[model samples]
Target: MIEVGSLTRRYGTTVAVDGLSFDVRPGTVTGILGTDGSGKSTTTRLILGLDGPDAGHVRINSRPIWRALLAAVRGRGAVRSPLLPPRSQRPTPSGALAAGGGMDPSRVGEVLGTVGIAGVARRRAGAFSLGMAQQLGIAGVLLRDPGVLLLDEPVNGLDPEGVRWISNLMRSPVARAP
Candidate 1:
């Protein structure tokens, strides 16, 4: 459901991504791997429309994500980044998930519960530990029930238990389907 064709990006004189192309089909997991400064984050940003590709295109569900956003009122797609907001500066879990609409309190609660942070649903996300913050970010993505899910280092901050939770959640049959 996600497609990248001839993707390229550059910053000043540095080339970050070069003619990248790949497809993430519906109901499957795909990972982009590389060492630091290898353009993984840049690629993710391009796919999510957070950054423009110097030359290339990214599409979700056969339409550009921006177009999809305009066509659908909810659940077009979602992503979480590695640079999370500061705990004290972040919004409450529910508020963050519902900020752009498409989710209600119960859905937010369900996502928070799935990520093992429901007990602190009303707390400011900025107060959570790194692992908890990661969970909340994952929860925000799940709340979308998106046609596409683009995650960049989603488990980077999790403890073993939290890592297992994300593993099981993503492997669930429901999560596997588009």
Candidate 2:
């Protein structure tokens, strides 16, 4: 369970989020959707505790989002957007995922396999298209298997098959559990 009350954020004169309130109940997938400049990302950041709200409150599963946000959000990239290294870097998806310490090869493999990109585990990320890049980003988040998921435009550039994979995952019991 995630809840927000009067969540508000301002930058100079711009109000990124304003008096927003909502609840994300288990057994369902909620989305913060809007047009450009609608503060969708800002709201997500605030919920994940990556950014502070000027005049509001947030809670997840009956607790404040203080300690569990990292595991919840996975990183800024998952809920904000992906930061892909240049193709010339020739980074493999699996290697790229395992670059940081603590994550083992099997975890990387499981995530890639779930996203249906296991075949490209050894392929250079630089060789991937926009859709594939989106999948990789999704795989990155799925690797954490967080209790709460906060994805942004997760299906933006995916092909039909990829879209189905993500939709299924998001609609699965994991995303809908109480």
Candidate 3:
């Protein structure tokens, strides 16, 4: 579970988040939406412990998140900005998963296949199209078999078929398993 209590953040005179509070239970899909610059990203940052909250707290699974590193480790899955490594440092999807650590080597092919990009599992990520890259990111998330998934603009570059694929995947019983 994710719990946010009276969270607040300010940038100089501007308020990015104000007294935000919510509870996200396990096996559910939650989305934060708003106009541009309406504190959506700021709230996500605060929840992830990427930035400090001025007046509230964030907890995951009943434990307060005290540091950025702990927050990163605690999350089952997340897709933040700049979805992949920079173009210059791109690696094959298999290699990328290897770099993330604690992942089973055999699962690389399995996850790639799950995301419908198995044929390109060995291709350099830098050369993949935007949709393929999004698939790669989703594959990474699925590799963890996470009970929680925080995806921002998950369908940003997908084709119709790809979009449908992801939708079905997210709604699958496996995705909601704890």
Best by TM-score: 3
Regions more than 4 Å wrong, model 2: 66-77, 174-178
The model with the greater TM-score, 1 or 2, is 2
**What is the C-alpha lDDT profile of model 3 across 1-178, one tens digit per residue?**
8899999999999999999999988877677888888898888887766789999998887788774346547456777643677899998888888678677778888888888999987888898888888888888877877667777777778899988987887787756776
Give the residue spans of candidate 3 off by over 4 A: 67-75, 86-89
Q: Rank the candidates by lDDT, best first.
A: 3, 2, 1
Q: Distance from true position, residue 17, model 1, in Å?
A: 0.7
Model 3 worst lDDT window (10 residues) = 67-76
What is the per-residue lDDT of model 1 for residues 1-178, given as tens digits with 9 covering 90 to 100?
A: 7789999999999999999999988778777899999999899888877898889888877897678556543544454543356645677878877774668888888878877889998987666777887777777767767666667777777889978987787787546767
- Which residue pairs of candidate 2 clash? 27-176
Query: What tens digits encode model 2's per-residue C-alpha lDDT throughout 1-178?
Result: 7889999999999999999999987667887789999999888888878799999888876667776565445432354565577767758989988885357999899888877889999988887877788878777766666556678788777788878887887877645544
**TM-score result, candidate 1:** 0.79
Clashing residue pairs in candidate 3 are none
All candidates: TM-score: 0.79, 0.81, 0.83
Decide which is better by lDDT, 1 or 2: 2
In model 1, state the lDDT of residue 7: 94
lDDT of 1 at 143: 73
Lowest lDDT sum, 10 consecutive residues, model 1, at 73-82
Between candidates 1 and 3, the one scoring higher on TM-score is 3
- What is the Å distance of residue 149 in model 3 from its true position? 1.9
Model 1 segments beyond 4 Å from truth?
64-69, 82-103, 122-126
